[model samples]
Target: MSRSSRVVFYSLSRKFVQEKQAPPKAQEVIYYSLAIGHHLGVIDCLQSRLECPLDGFNRWVAQLPSGGAARRKLEGLGRFGEICIDSTHTHLLATALSKAAPLLTDEQQSWSQRLIDLLQLIENEPAIYLMVRRRDG
Candidate 1:
């Protein structure tokens, strides 16, 4: 980006980062709105420069940090990855299952189950000795 654009982005970023806290619900709305605004600005800038509306929000979602105590609580379960991907998919899916299940799907689910079964089988198998010489033998 040019120096002026970089300066504006940094200024806006600092404004959002340094804002005063609000009540729980208000805080959520405030931060989310700011994040959406930032994302839009980024998308517009990138599209203008690249000559395409870059459809990489999935990649962006993966790289965004999970913020706040609530985020930690949600992530404590194995739900964060599932929820994050689901949320990101909502923005791009627009009714396409392929886009919706980029990382999870029916066939992949079956494959994952089969792989788990194989792992269990391997875990239950007895060890085999190849070559050994015991001094006491």
Candidate 2:
């Protein structure tokens, strides 16, 4: 990205981090990440939020720490091969799945599956689908 773009991303990232405590921008981050096809960014943002559950109206927001000096560090989930998600993350992931399921194309499904599997959900597992059902039911 250009120098100005970097400044804007950092500025927005900080604003969202703060907003997460009050107004919450978690879903926006998800949609943006998805729109840009930044799969790793999607997972990182989602995982961070799962790690630190927000409260109040902004409860949906996850708290991701500020990225380091290297600009690329902020763009994707580094070392994704070693990532793991706990029960809370699984629950959140399922929620995201349900919301995005209808709009997701086959190619996007392939991308979504990576995030799902990173959270340890097996492909085409009947039990995993139950999580979304439980939420919608």
By TM-score, the best candidate is: 2
What lDDT would candidate 1 get against the real structure? 0.28
With candidate 2 superimposed using the best TM-score fit, by how many Å does residue 61's alpha carbon deviate from the native? 13
Backbone clash pairs in model 1 (N, Cα, C under 3 Å; residues 3+ apart or in different chains), count: 0
Estimate the TM-score for candidate 2. 0.26
Best by lDDT: 2
Candidate 1 has what TM-score?
0.19
- Residue 33, candidate 2: Cα error in Å is 35
Model 2, C-alpha of 133: deviation from truth (Å): 30
- The regions of model 1 sitting more than 4 angstroms off are 1-103, 126-137
**Cα lDDT of model 2 by residue, 10-115, tens digit:** 0011212223232365666654554454343432232122121112101121112223222122122222212233344554554565465555656445544554
Q: How does residue 26 of candidate 1 score in lDDT?
A: 73
TM-score of each: 0.19, 0.26
